[model samples]
Target: MLAVAWAASGDSHEVRLCVTDKRLVWLRDDAIADRVRALRLAEVDEVVARTGRVRRQGELRVRARTRRRRLRFGEIAPGPLRELAEALAQVLPAGAVRLPAA
Candidate 1:
């Protein structure tokens, strides 16, 4: 499991990559509550491809400290997002993962 957290422009966001069943599970702050939410790798891929690059994954969970207020999406590098997609690709069943660069 790899956990990465950073505060972009004063707002804090956290991303956790976990290997489950040989698949990568991405969990991030919901921005609505202190709870976390899991993101589907396929959905993320589509968003990246549509935007011509991987933008922020958007709010994953609600913030507990912010009274359930949603956090604004932050910017992420396309390279890192591609890397993450690759990581997810490895875990998905064969032919399920479609990377943006592929």
Candidate 2:
């Protein structure tokens, strides 16, 4: 994995973000195997990064060609999320990842 991040779940658990060579995976921290979801890099159309108006926190979502609905990753620190997006850009086609204006 290139980058890993965590977000607090509503149940007080953690939602883990895993960025790997093949895909972006999201799963519960406690249950790494079960209930896992993935978005393949090859199928990704665009990656959108957005920040909250108040806290300056951010989140990432993926628009994939193979899926109708966008895959939403949990909220995380903007710095790490940007790094993750850049890592993805290295593998993905040009203009595949989009970040908010700095």
Model 1 steric clash total: 10
Candidate 2 clashing pairs, residues 3+ apart or interchain: none
Taking all chains together, each candidate's TM-score versus the true structure is 0.41, 0.80
RMSD of each: 8.6, 2.7
lDDT of 2 by residue, 1-102 (tens): 887777644432568777898998777767635657677888889998776778877778888899888767656787877877777877788988887657
User: Which candidate should be chosen as best, given TM-score against the real structure?
Assistant: 2
Error of 2 at 69 (Å): 0.8
Each model's lDDT comes to 0.38, 0.76
Q: Which ten residues in a row have the lowest lDDT in candidate 1?
A: 42-51
Highest lDDT: give the candidate number: 2
| TM-score result, candidate 1 | 0.41
